[model samples]
Target: MSESSDRLQRRSAPKRLTADDWADAALAALAERGLAAVAVEPLAARLGTTKGSFYWHFANRDALVAAALARWEEVSTERIIRAMETAEPDPAARLGALLRGATLSVVDDPLEVRLLAAGDHPEVAAALARVTERRIGYLAHLFELLGFPAPEARHRGFFAYTSYLGHAQVAHAVPGAVPTDPAYLAAVTAALLKR
Candidate 1:
């Protein structure tokens, strides 16, 4: 092979980028340039790799989007579900605790907030809706554990999900917002939950 051909082949050989690494690079690209900038070509370039690597790991753009949504769910919705599951289990206190834990967890995690805030893409929105529904169902189950009637528990669960997401939306839109204050959020959530 010619010298140029050899160099090109060596450079194009797959580099090791884990799912987490690709996600991280994609998140950074999302933050630095916004959602439109997160196309696979740019993401691949950002990872010091190529589009072939992305397809090798994911089925298509839809699949990659699902991965991003899954990661967001892991950090955001899953945290809430896990917190509710492990906390005191009194519906009110558990709800408060989940919000508190999630609020604390959000400190400086802008990418997490941004991804959660993205309800624009139809696929992302669908994935998030599924995650949110599961979370609400879990919350309803938690309420049933606390003596709430079946229907009431279901309504409350949906309400809680909406409230938390609403807060996330507000947090994402408010420039210079920080999750440094626990007492305020806890107090706010506690008051809000009791209503």
Candidate 2:
């Protein structure tokens, strides 16, 4: 083909998908189903693309899984902490806000619970460990700012994190079992923030 013909063909071609696009689709699959659902062909079909698009961004399914996990960690943990820090000025209030938000929110796909169930997978396990530590550490810092000593702060942080995990699991596995009303959320926050 002539150079002009080649240029025209390239210009008319479909836009290439980015790695983030693949990672996001993979994460949606992970959240909806499980780690097992993050296969290349299925995700490609979901994205209305081909396996060639998947291979262009990720070496294999494991790499795609890792990328999805990383995106989840960044979105679910890091950005949340940042938002909490910015949104609340008082430490105790921040902790309470965190509790209320976490408890009252309704998620269609329980990504955390799904990842926890898939914890046996190596990528999921590693990502879970990192997110667990980071979340608990941030909670501990907030507790410390609220006047709790380091050890006490850490313990309370762990307790708070576990409470969130339990809430997520209950909300996902058995909807309507846990009360998500404002009164219930307030009670839970009051109990958690009790000195």
The per-candidate count of clashes, in order, stands at 0, 0
Model 2 regions more than 4 Å off: 1-15
Best by TM-score: 2
lDDT of 2 by residue, 10-90 (tens): 998887899889999988887888888989999989988999999888899888888888888888788888999899899
TM-scores, all models, native as reference: 0.69, 0.89
Q: Which lDDT values do the candidates have, in the order given?
A: 0.69, 0.86
Best by lDDT: 2
Worst 10 residues of 1 by lDDT: 104-113
- The regions of model 1 sitting more than 4 angstroms off are 1-15, 31-33, 83-93, 111-118, 176-180, 192-195
lDDT of 1: 0.69
